[model samples]
Target: MAIYSAERRRLMEMLHPGRHQVFSEVLSSLGAFMEKEILPLSPKLDAGEASIAKPRKALFEQGMTAIPFPVQYGGLGLPFSVYAMAVEMLGNADASVALSVEIHNAVAEGLLRYGSDGQRKKHLAAVISGKTLASFGLTEPASGSDSSTMATTAEKKGGEYVINGSKMFITNAGEASLYMVFAKTAKGPSCFLVEAPNPGLKFGKDLKKLGMRGSKTSEVIFDGCRVPEGSLVGQEGEGGEYAKEILHGARIVVAALNVGISQIAYDKSIAYAKSRKAFGKPISEFQLIREKIADMKTGIDAGRLMYLYAARIKEMGGDYTSEASQAKVYATEMSLKACDEAIQIHGGYGYTTDDLHRHWRDARLLTIGEGTSEVLRMLISRKELSRAQ
Candidate 1:
């Protein structure tokens, strides 16, 4: 059975007629561009390490550089829905690259929303054009789910604020030109825009992980790193609020990425099942294989719908924290299952690295990164309880 019914497609199409058209064009363009310009470059770089560096320039030039931001800053300023669909397509092709771009967009959106005119002029253009990259520095070594426990401190000095703390598992940490770092100031936990190459800012060696190898993940060490007093982003004591809002929106993006991955895994598995034979016929002819394919397709479709719903809520400027968490948790878990089923359908070949094991490895990270499945469950439970009260 086809998971996406005509009614569902029509509803999705109706969400934003003009924007969807543009999104479709951009997705098609991105797919072609990745095949020719980006994926071909993947071989030259560490399939894992190259995620941060390899596609940064091309993605900016060909993808993000033209969307989301204002025309004044060399961007198309397209609707968020369009930008999100493009992200989903990119994610389907290469998640590491998609994630890197997503992080950049997240930071850029923060700057656009909270940055002063001077700050925007100084930084936004380069970021929009891809001349420079940025990362969000919120997760501390000790603070993963509980950001309130973050201990990174920023002390005031003469005409400057000195930051001393470390951010762990930061994407695009070493390679970024700017970092939006959160720290404890006298006022409270505040955000600071720290420029790169500062004497006091250091990056630990890249941490090896099980998946998402293409995206660079590292720890940032801040030892009395100083930036001007004007470097503060948004109002003092309001960093937490900003962080929450950013994260709420980010959850939707993460869900979209996972949905994309799930769809790709389903497609690959379906193709593989049709070709791989067992007994006297193709394995796909078996009832068990048919059941697996049906389940995988159903999961991917459900995940995609959840993501689109979340995206729509965001577009409507609704309070989407619960919906976003639901989407993230559901889609990521679905992708993990779908990926596993894909491997199971492949049987022995799936266990081997040469087969679709890489997709499985990549899917593993979806459940953990951004926000772990556990954290998301807690978030959803809290929201539900609050509403009941």
Candidate 2:
């Protein structure tokens, strides 16, 4: 089956028929490209035989990263929902590449949302064009996803800021050309755009993972890391708010990503069930198997709708914090269930095969990354409670 399946088409048609056709065509063509070029690399990517940089750069040249930003900063000026859908396509192709690219794009998002015009002109276009690979550096050693407890600090010293601290589990860590670093100032948490090749900036060795092994993850250490005062992206002591805003948008994309993972796993299970024989016939004919398929499809559909709803709200310039968190929590948890069922459908092969079981391994990360389900639930409830009051 095509990566951009009929279900996706029907969903798009339901959303906006004539208006979304262009975006639909773009996604279809991109999906075709990924199936041909990138899908072949997925197994290799998982096994550490291929590099993510080349395929990702090809996507950059395809304007994948450029989709959601304003045209002025070299973006396609498309709605954020379009970009979210594109990420879904990417996730279907390869979760690792999707994860790496989304984190890179998140940095561009920070610049677009909070950076000055000069900063946007200088950094945003490069990131959008993939000329400079970007990394989000908010998660620290002591703080997994909590920005409030980040121990990193930046002190102003004679027209420069000296940063000292380390960030853990940073995606695209060593490979990123630009790092969006958040550290505390006297005021509070602040953000800085630290470029690569700084003498004081160091990267630990790449950390291996259960899945998404294709992408680089490592520790980003800053010891007396001096950057020009201009490196500060926005006002001092507001990085916490900036980080929160960026993550709120990112949660939606993460939802879409998990949906993609679920779709692929479901597709594989269906194909396997049709061929794998049972006591009398193919397992697809079995009632229990049919039930799993139905539930998987339903969950995937619901997850997609949730993210698109949140994405549309965002496009309308409304407050989407609660909606985004809801989508992230629901979609990610749904993905785990879908992927787990897929393994059950495939039975022995799913357990023995790396490529088959990797879906579960990959889906497992979304729950813990970005913001944990527990944390996001609290956030959604807090937002709703405030609204009600």
Candidate 3:
């Protein structure tokens, strides 16, 4: 049985109209790739170094990089709707891989929006081809949601700028070839492209996390790391604005990922309920079990619709900060709830180190990363109050 019903299909169609065919095709391709390649590689990557390198290399070898960039940059130039669908499908199979891919795309989008023409020509093509991995360095040990208070400083000295600070919980930190680091400059907060292998650039060991184990998250330290003056991205003092633009779009993508995870959890719970019998009958036949299923399905459907709406608003060139915040907050919380219920439905089996348990653990990270639920609530409230004023 298909998880997406006809009504859901019609809803998506109504929202996207002529865009559905391309979106469906990208989703189908991503679904097949995730099942055949990404999911199978997750266990190996989670195992150790040697095993991890193979899939990481294979992801580049395959055409997965085309999902985000424009055709001029050797990408599929796929619509944001298609990109969201592809990410949702990938997240359903392996969130770690999905996360790694998502960060790379986010960085690419940021560069496209803020990078100079020379910077784009020099960097974007390599990124789209997966020859270069980029990390966004915005969140710090001291600056998670409150970016204005970041302590990272960049000082211009003649023809170069020296950077000094540390970034915590950075995705692809050790593995990335380049980093889009934000630091307080004389003009204000500015972004600079810092290349790896620099003597002053250092990476701390990966922080052991509760979930998303296969993805590398580490701390980056810049001790007087210097880059050419030309490395600055966009206008000086606009780094925060640039970061916000990147994140507004990214929040929706994260929402799509959460929707995918929630759907998977719901499916697993439903299957377990049908197969596990109690009192000489399937647990799915019980009223309480049916109610759990109903709630899970309803939450997933609502979250999915919110994700699509946010994406549509973005594609239409609308200001969707409030909409994106709502989608991300709702979808992530819904996923957490669904995962908890899935674990409950699985009884003792879910508590073990099984796939369902892994899903539950992975689902926890979505709420905290990107932006915390508390922070998102504040953003939504602030926007509403501003509009009222």
Candidate 4:
């Protein structure tokens, strides 16, 4: 089955109506590529039979990471919505690969937003062009959702800054060529671009995960790790805001990713409901089964529109934190619900089949990864309340 659906095309048309020709061409090409190359790898990625690097690298070569970046940085210079939709397709193709690629692109997004000229010239093009792999290193073992309370520290020592403490649950940990790490300085929290192969940097073994098994997640240890003074992306003490901004954009992409998972699960449920017979008739004819299909489709549409709206706001240079949070919270939960309903519709086969149930496993991580649903709800509420005042 095609990963990109008619509904997805219609949604794109809704965004620009008759002017979505460029978007259509790019999306159709990407969808076709994913259907052939990435979709077949989903089960193997979950089962650990294949490594995440090769397919991810192939996608990067497809300019997936470069979509929303500036053309000077070897990007396609497309809008953020294009990138978000691409991510949705990727999620349907293979959630593990999508997770890894999105984390890698997050680093690129940070550099584009906050890095200096030399930093951008040196690392930005390489990162977006797939010459180097980057990983986000903001969360720590001591600090989960509360990023401001992170324990990692960076002390200036002449021309270099010495970094200590560790980052936990870091995606692409061992494999990343560059690490976009956050640490506390005497002034305040700061962002630094730390290169790999440093003597002081070490990574813990890849953590066995509940899902997104293809991507490596581990503890990144910084024992007096040092980077040149130029490694600082933006001014010191401002990293907190930078981190927040980066995450806001990432939340939209995360929402898109979950929507992709829901689409696949919904598609599978539909096909199954038609093919699987009960009481000498297809389950699709049953009122209860039809209700499940309707609910799944509705949730998928709502989740897709939420992310797209958030992405559009972001592209317009508006404050999208509230919208981003709302999209993330809703889409992640929506994905979980859609996957669960799929399993229910599939009866015993969904419970037993690895391929069918893996959608739930993959969707489970997004609720806790970028931002917890509970925290996002609070953020949305706080923003709304502040606006009301």
Candidate 5:
């Protein structure tokens, strides 16, 4: 079934009545593009038969990268919900591509929320327009969730900040032209905009991964990488705050993407169960198989609702940190379960087939990438406890 014409339309109508038509039109247009340009390349992407850059550039040209930014900066200026649903569609098209684009957009989001006016005019437009791909450099080998313990440092040299540190598991690392890097300054943690081709900017070899192979993942090393004073975003010592804000928003999109993966996996399972036979009848006719299908469908629906609820709360300008964390924790775990069920229903064929198994592999990374399921659970409970007082 077409994702846009089905549950997407239903949810859009329930959440946005007056604007649903316009949203649907824009999404459908993007969906059509995905169906033609992206879906066909999934197998090739997974197998290393094709380059991700080609499809990503095609998407950029079609304006997929500028969905939620302000029109003044070359974006469509649409609501966050619309951009999120578009991400879900992209996830269904190709998980790797979706991941690469998601990280790229997170950098744009950082600049939008924290950059100076001159910085926005100079850098944000290029990023949103896809002239320059961006990466978020917040993760380090020694520090994953604890930002305060980061060892990366940025020292003020006469007219520049000399950065020295390493960022691990950075998505779109080698392919990006701009990086929103976080490091320590005298005041505290700070954010900086570091351009590529600097004397001290270097990349480690792309790390091989179990999934999302279509995207580049590598270590970014900043050995005395120097940038002008104007490269500071907002102010020195605000990087921690900016990183937290950027991540809270990103968690919602990650949830939506996982839901998309679940939807596709569930659909494939249903189709296979109907056709594959056992005991002289379709396995789908069996009670156990039917139960798996029902559970998968229910979980996908639940995940979709959770992320959409968080997105709606955010668009309304409310505090959604708890909601976003809840959505991410639930949806990422739910996608894993759903994909596992899909593989179980597919049996031996699923284990051997890259197409069927790739979904599960792709879903595995989400639970650990943005925030580990364990960490998010703790964060959610902490918020609830504080609110109770």
Candidate 6:
């Protein structure tokens, strides 16, 4: 069965029945492409036997990166929910690719929201169209999720801004052709569109990771990386705000991605339960096994609905920050639980198998990445309290 066949239909029916056929057609085609091209590469990607470049390029050619943007920038002009669903499918196929593509789209989003007309003309189209790949540079060694404490600095020199400091754990670090770099200026936090191959820009070796190894992660160092004044995105000192807004949307997508991971893990567990025999019958017949299966499916459904709810709010142009955080917190933790139950249901095989455990591994990152669950809880509470007041 297709990944988006059943639940996706329900989501589209609830959120956008009028466009259901269009979404089904486009996503079905994309899902077919993923099953053919990306799924086969997942094992190789996990084993370090294949580079992610070819499959990533293939996905880009299929216009996965341009799904939610406006038509003027070569996007499909689809609703954000469609894009969220697409990310879920990608996560089902391969988490690393989903992470890379998600971060890339976030950069496109940043440009759309904050870039000047010239910057948009120069970079946004290329990025969404996948003519150029971009990475976000905000997190630093000392600053994990807290952007206010970032130590990176940019100084005005004549007409150029000279940036200094490093970004840690940057996704697509070495491979990206452009970076949306954030740094402190005399005014405050700022954003710069730094293109690749600058004399002052350098990337550290790719870090060996416990999961999502298919995507590149490294330190991005800026030794006085210089860019023209025009490279600045939005107003100076507003990069922090831009980053927050960008991340709110990203949290929704991250939630979708985790739901995808949970779906895959749940599917695998169900198949395993039906096939693997215990006590002369399929283990799925056991009461405990059935309970785990029920919880896994329920959690996956709840996570999917939560993210889609956040996406709907975003589509309607409402304040979705708290909703986004709630989805991220719930879905990420829910995925971890589902994957763990999947591993438990598989028993010894799950503990030893890379394919089974990798789902858990990949799901593990999101809880810590976008916004840590603890932090998101606080943010959500603060929003609710302020709204009540």
Worst 10 residues of 4 by lDDT: 1-10
Task: Kindly indicate the candidate among 3 and 5 with the higher TM-score.
Answer: 5
| Superposed model 5: Cα runs more than 4 Å off | none
| lDDT of model 5, residue 24 | 85
- Model 5, TM vs. native: 0.99
**TM-score for candidate 4, residues paired by index:** 0.98
Question: By TM-score, is 3 or 6 better?
Answer: 6
Query: What tens-digit string does per-residue lDDT give for candidate 1 at 128-223?
Result: 788888889999889988888989998989999999989999988899989998998888889889999999999999899776677888999999
Query: Mind giving the per-residue lDDT tens digits that candidate 4 earns over 229-286?
Result: 9999899999998998899999999999999999999989999999999999999999
The candidate 6 region of ten consecutive residues with least summed lDDT is: 1-10
Candidate 2 ranges with C-alpha deviation above 4 Å: none
- TM-score of candidate 3 versus the correct structure, residues matched by position: 0.94
lDDT (Cα, 0-100) at 322 in candidate 5 = 93
Q: What's the count of clashing pairs in each model shown?
A: 2, 0, 0, 0, 0, 0
Residue pairs with backbone overlap in model 6: none
**What would the TM-scores of all predictions be?**
0.92, 0.98, 0.94, 0.98, 0.99, 0.99
* Candidate 5 residue-wise lDDT at 268: 93
Please list the residue runs of candidate 4 whose C-alpha ends up more than 4 Å from where it truly belongs after superposition: none
lDDT of 5 by residue, 77-196 (tens): 888988889888888889999999999999999999999999999999899988998999989999998879999999999999999999999999989989999999999999999999
Better of 3 and 4 by lDDT: 4
lDDT of 3 by residue, 1-389 (tens): 23233444565577668876665655555566567777766555545432444565566556565665689988887667667766676677777777887888888888889999999999998887788988889999988889999999999999999999999999999899989999999888898999998987999998898877888899999999989999999988999999989999999999988887887788789889999999999999999989989999999889888888888788888888998999999999999999999998998897974578777778899988888999999999999899899
Error of 1 at 271 (Å): 1.2
What is the Cα-based lDDT of residue 165 in candidate 4? 99
lDDT of each: 0.78, 0.92, 0.82, 0.92, 0.91, 0.93
Global lDDT of model 4: 0.92
